[model samples]
Target: MSEDVLSQGEIDALLSAISSGEMDADELKEQKQEERKVRDYDFKRALRFSKDQIRGLTRIHENFARLLTSFFAGQLRSFSEVSVASVDQVPYEEFVRSMPQRTVLNIFSVEPLEGRIMYEVNPNIAYAILDRTLGGEGKSSNKVDSLTEIESRIMSRLFEKAFESLEEAWGSLVEIDLTLEEFEVNPQFIQMVSPNETVVIVSLNAQIGETSGMMNICIPHMVLEPIISKLSVHYWMQKEKTKSSPEDAEHLSKSLNNVDVEAKVLLGESGVSIEEFLKLNQEDVIMLNQSIEEPLVMHINNEPKFYVQPGKQKRHMAVQILGETRGEEE
Candidate 1:
């Protein structure tokens, strides 16, 4: 605390400056007040996530963007692109106020987590998706104020299917089962979190064909608080490293063992003039270049793998593996 106490020389210099009119007394008082104001903190707008956590959120959502791009491309049967625009933290009330009056607000719950999150789509993109799904040239109906019963069901089903991609994207960070709980057009009607609750907003820019708009995801701090530590670059890196364990390799080998592969034995190769081939009669004999004792090459998935001898087993013809095929012969 010695640094906090003023020295005699410093006190004398301050008094001399004040007496000489070098510094105004009122100005000094106001400067101290301004410094105090600068130090004031607002709990309502608290930052719950660190920079590393925000970067992890960005990386996760970037992957979600890619998955959404492919999903929309296939579902709409049009060119689609999705990319991360920004990730920010703000009060829940501010996020709600920033939304347009009429938009697609999907409230979904992540199972094994306590609270719900919002997936909001801009009116333009939502209408574009609806128009495309209904067999029109992908276009947005800007004047849409409400969804009809049919339209609501269609969109609900469409987004529910799209959530599969969301599930897959978050699988690396956490296993979540997303169930669409509610759908609303008016933001005022929904209050999943407190007004001043801290929430992270992930904005995504999406274009389906010629229509493009923003998609925002609102996740409250309370919802993420439980697993907040997992939302870090270090955790993601560790998770990725764990995926390559011996158990995973064994599981992969077992999965591959069940896969079917085509294997065909090449009997021989013979060439003849087109005219001679066309003029050939029934029971016509064309001698092949391969000799009887020569082993036939066996091709697996169209690549020569081994040499085998042709023979019959019971009622079916089969080939006896002789040895591996020489690369030079191939």
Candidate 2:
């Protein structure tokens, strides 16, 4: 009150008190800057998935989400749409703590990958499915605390089917077998990842007929470390581009038209010893397993391609294709 202009230190102290409510303004500012700063870049606490990896996983799981809806529609004969909600990286402990007290957590491993991953479905979704499967209306009002023995069994089947769909959806990227390791209701007891370890979470929101719920897939960075290269956009794009184009197919057909193919006709096969072969000198008959009525097998490039019968085509020893082998893929 006596001085017109206070000293710089006096002014700063008064300003800090007004700005920080008795705390040092500079200290408050510095504390705010300490949160998740990139400069802090702790190697032990790095992101589970990079931005690119998260984008790739988003693209991959979007397909899975769409397929999941269709699968539910077919099985439950109901309308539904499961959409990818978000892909994020968070500390594993944060995720575990966010889970409800009563939740069904499925721990599984990818056969082609090294470590385990987890799948968590909301209880509302589980109950809705249980009701639908048990011939009741597929709707829920209150959240379930725990699944009964019968309910758990039913949910296990549902989880199996969902994982089958997941396996099929992941087939193009990596042929993985999702085998369940264990199931738990108490998340505190489940320690799939260390408390501070980072994990990648892919969330899918489901609108199954009348019920709406969420599902999460948690994969620790360690599990994805080995095949992280496969999670890049370039790899997926190259795989798509490597498929035969129309021009490529035409060129292949034209080139094959000019090349010579070694074709052979086989009646059948019969087990004959080496001694029996030595005994046969000239014009010795070897009994065949296939009868005369049975069609001969046409061997193209040493592979049995088709069943054919010996016939005359324009005065040539040609054979007609009767049919193809059953259960053979093209």
C-alpha RMSD by candidate, in order: 10.3, 20.0
The number of the candidate with the highest TM-score is 1
Local distance difference test scores for all models: 0.89, 0.81
Q: TM-scores of the models, in the given order?
A: 0.66, 0.61
Over 257-279, each residue of candidate 1 has an lDDT whose tens digit, in order, gives 99999999878889999999899
The superposed Cα distance between candidate 1 and the true structure at residue 288, in angstroms, equals 26
Summing lDDT over every window of 10 consecutive residues in candidate 2, give the lowest-scoring window.
Answer: 35-44
Best by lDDT: 1
Tens-digit lDDT track for model 2 on 88-204? 988888898888887778888888888889999887887777677777778864445555777777777777777777787777778888888787767887898788888988988
Candidate 1 stretches with Cα past 4 Å from truth are: 1-40, 243-330
Q: Candidate 2 clashing pairs?
A: none
